[model samples]
Target: MSTTPMFPSNLLPNEASPEWMNKGDNAWQLTAATLVGLQSVPGLVILYGSIVKKKWAVNSAFMALYAFAAVLICWVGWGYRMSFGESLVFFWGRPAVALDQKFLLEKAFVGMYPTATMVFFQFVFAAITLILIAGALLGRMNIYAWMLFVPLWLTFSYTIGAFSVWCPTGWLAKAGVIDYSGGYVIHLSSGVAGFTAAYWVGPRASADRENFPPNNIILMLAGAGLLWMGWTGFNGGDPYVVSIDASLAVLNTHVCAATSLLVWLFLDIIFFGKPSVIGAVQGMITGLVCITPAAGVVQGWAAILMGVMSGSIPWFSMMVLHKKIALLKQVDDTMAVFHTHAVAGSLGGILTGIFAEPKLNRLFYQVDDWEKYIGLAYGLNSGRTSAGFHQMGVQLGGILFIIVLNIVTTSLICLFIRLIMPLRLSDKELEVGDDVVHGEEAYSLWGDGEIFDNTKHYTEHNTAFDLEDGSSSMKKTATEVQLT
Candidate 1:
């Protein structure tokens, strides 16, 4: 027998794939989709809601909610095609929507899964990218302006990045770059765009900064929990096929995140009096971002090391550099999007070279022939002593290119929009949050259709004076205190 393993001629088509594979793939796709959906809905949604002070609760929530909706509409309409369709002159995919059931079911895909599964899986990535961008503009952006910016950015900028990185025939993919997941496309792009938008939009109101404490810590915890769990899909869905490699990818992603979380908590205990829940969430996010590019390619041990670097480096950048470096301070990345996504993404890109294993690369590449060829170029067959390092250098180059492009493009977009319409809210609106702007509050306990409370002992708090809007005749002293 030949050294190569032999199989039946008819085995070319996957026979193990029962009709249930369609069901199974879709089930996995939906499961993964919902996990990603949770990240925005209750995950980052509540995290932002609780992290910001009470005054900006509605504002933060709206930013996340709007991005979630806006990205979906754009994805199904045009953004999806631009990323995954046949390469549009190498930079993007062909412009077309995969809306019909027949097209989705019978569509041909070159990679790990069916076309339908791939479309939905990719849609989540695009959606989350917008959600991540929303973090920077959370506290102070106008609802109208944000509503407009999401589709515009998704159409002009995000699609380009997704297409460049993921489309099989795109220039970046053809150049033998391996993202595995979304280190450059999602995290790095969002991080840079977020910082640019934040700087362009300007800081929150002075009062907001003075007392921007979290409104609801419990809600924040809910959001953080979802983010932690949702990452299984974020990494796992990349492989598309429900194979051993997919399982390994998911494991690697979690291991990195867990390791990073522990490292961050330990560091916090050493430095601060106690560990903070917020700090732990930051560590979790950093770990996820760091492992994006290397999740499938690296061993679990390498993931642990990457996790440490991600958690520590980004934490230092956010905590120390933002405070110490005046230039970074001026940028006002509202939720530290740059520190978490950009810094961690860059770190992950570099580490992918250092940690990628020979075997995993082969399995992932064997899923497609073009990938097979490129895999060989960078795999164990390469004569260069430091080929992984060389591949890593390519990854770094991609990261830098993304950063510069986002900075320039996002700044220009913001400047153009500012020239036409005001980006920040008025002084009066800033003092009051969603109640005055959207005319809707997140919660209403007394569902009596009116905010009229006539109880004798009741007191209502305002930004300035506490008004005794009650039926009582007794005089009450006004206290100038900020509400927690």
Candidate 2:
């Protein structure tokens, strides 16, 4: 045989080529998609595992892992088409497979790249949204029940929000509702859906809810750091090409996150008398969500103002309002996702109408409709106050639509899941946590590799108890792994 390598007969010399494609854009898009994927996989995975009670670590992490895989399978099968394909109506596209090679290689709308890149990029967002919702149900949701809930919610609640707010043909999009990268579709929807599901699934076991503590604060920070960095792609990739808007979005994202985190830390010190790392993380998340809808369209100063409001407002909701509000207290939101995502997301949408810059809006949305995208502050400056109010109205409308949509869809889905099987874990499973549920422990520390016993582990003085291997546990205390 010749020394030359053989090519498949069906493969063309430029098989990866699309005449309209920008190679750089395609590469960046794929990289961005992977970054977003990393946020859910190791980022949220680590975050969930280490942020829950030690006994629930494995279960919480597994919930996120399973959703990531499930969403991808559903995404390529029919979910992608329903959200971005041919319009089925004002808020949905016709369901169809996104896997055909020819279609995957075709140019995606707006992006000068193959449709495959768009599919993967969108899929990561879809997956992460579900994972965020999982945060609320952590420490208690039944795994098999969660398996069914993921696909169902994705199909019903997530797709509608995405198509309505993100798809070019969506009614909200046509109406010029700003959602540059899923403040409404992903963050807002996940927050609301998670809370609603939590209400229906019921609360975690009383003990777990009362005394749950993060398993590993350092590892939790590591995961949070990844999520913080991964947002570079989350907002930056929305424009679907490298440009000044992308750079502005990236800068604004970090600026807001830093500002919000400090504000939250300050609030925690003043009230709780400590600078909680978890509080700082929540503030960072709220800031990220707050700027998401207007990230590319707001000036730097406006981003700072939005960050300040996001830091304080969501803090109030989660800390003060959650305590006073009966509905909030009744639904044990294990991760406070409603405050971090839903409240912050709605706040961002409204603020987008107030802070969105006309010139930047023109650059990001590529629209010249002075009547449609002008922020309220700019409207006053430019003598277009009525137009700014209109934009605000549209933003409010989008928020209402999303909230009502999720409330109904999520409730029905949860009820359906309940009919099939209990949504929450059994009492024994809840008592034993990950070990009884999954037959696995997150960390192994027994001298003889025996299963963990709460009575023998927590509450009891392990330092004085004898090990099964006839070793004096008190002598080996320093080497033992312990839960707080």
Candidate 3:
């Protein structure tokens, strides 16, 4: 029935696989995006769920889960364009929906892939930033308040930072601020915004604050391993191509993380008399954050130096300085995100200006301007001292902008959310934890649909007795029956 003549031989390029599209690049971008998404979904989810007190495990993990879903919805709806669309102002982009097939199938602004790939890649970053902020508010923030806070903060604080630093037309970008990945847009912003939100949400219950311990250290390690490996995508995909720079970025990311972990472990042994696993995780995270800005721009030796500094500086900040600073002491950063992300991120930015190689910058930025992007050390050696100092100034300026932006925007968003609902949970809910708040628990091992009730058990002579399975009598000490 003339099947061969049904279609013309000369047709327009296929929409799914355009002539401009690079299949390998598209594949790697999608794979990298999935890897980044994994870092949040099961990685942070498991970490948050296992790292908190057992009573609060469900709540902590749910916060991360909800942010991931909510951010994807918002990103496709309008958030993506707001962060990367046409300029609405010097620091913001025009808000526009990113779901149109025409837009999605087109070439992306930066990568050699469809715009859809870039949107997905960027959405994972936005989602993780909100999840990081959740670490600070866990154990006490009202679910409704958090629900409101996520979209609000994403709309206000996140988009602004993303637009200002990442967008090509951004003032900061034009001014030569270097954020190879998201040391500024994600890490620093999350750390400062998280700390600020924690201030407004208030602390957890006094009892929880005093005695909180990880419910599952082993599971925490597993989650952390996922996070560590997933960073291969985090820094690698930033180069927007499958090239030598991308390979170098991936190698630097892991090297810095390992070095930072060892340094932090050694510091813990020297000062605390024990090598803390939690300390190692914090070190790894700081190293990841610190190297993000400079990953593709610095050499292997520079990455190692950055790792050492990241491990030691953030450790001291969290261990010694946090206690000494009144403002830091007042803010109850549950995950110490301020130290791991904010401090490390800013340090990375400054060091990027110091150690970034001019040749590497030309490779990444595709610019050979000797007067810009020159590291301070290189500048002195190259007789371009002005360029180096200028790069350093730009880096410092970016850090200052992020800190002030997060503090102000986060405070306003929290205050606005407070007008709609209470920011903190009720005292009873705080005391009872996940079971009271979500009507669920992380572990239901004792009985089907039943939460352990300390009030129902009686303790005498260090022995406790309570009903088991609603039909049998079980004997155990109150301490033994208590959930971990």
Off by over 4 Å in 2: 1-15, 367-371, 448-484
Best by TM-score: 3
Model 2 global lDDT (CA atoms, 0 to 1): 0.89
* Model 3 lDDT at residue 324: 97
Assess every candidate by TM-score.
0.85, 0.90, 0.91
Error of 1 at 29 (Å): 2.3
After superposition of all CA atoms, the RMSD between model 3 and the true structure is 5.8
The ten-residue window of minimal lDDT in model 2 covers 466-475
Ordered by TM-score, highest first, the candidates read 3, 2, 1
Question: With candidate 3 superimposed using the best TM-score fit, by how many Å does residue 387's alpha carbon deviate from the native?
Answer: 0.2
Candidate closer to the true structure by lDDT (higher is better), 1 or 2 = 2
Model 2, range 322-438, lDDT digits (tens) per residue? 999999999989999999999999999999988988888888877556447888889888999998888889999999999999999999999998888999898867876776688
User: Can you write out model 3's per-residue Cα lDDT over 1-484, one digit (the tens) per residue?
Assistant: 6665443433334755676888778889888889999999999999999999998999999999999999999999989999999999999999999999889988899748899999999999999999999998889999989998999999999999999999989999989998999999999999999999999999988888998999999999998998999999999999888879999999999999999999999999999899899999999999999999999999999999999999999999999999999999998889989999999999999999999898888889875453488789999899999988999999999999999999999999999988889999998677767766887778855567575654332223223553332212332343455544
Candidate 1 minimal-lDDT segment of 10 residues: 471-480
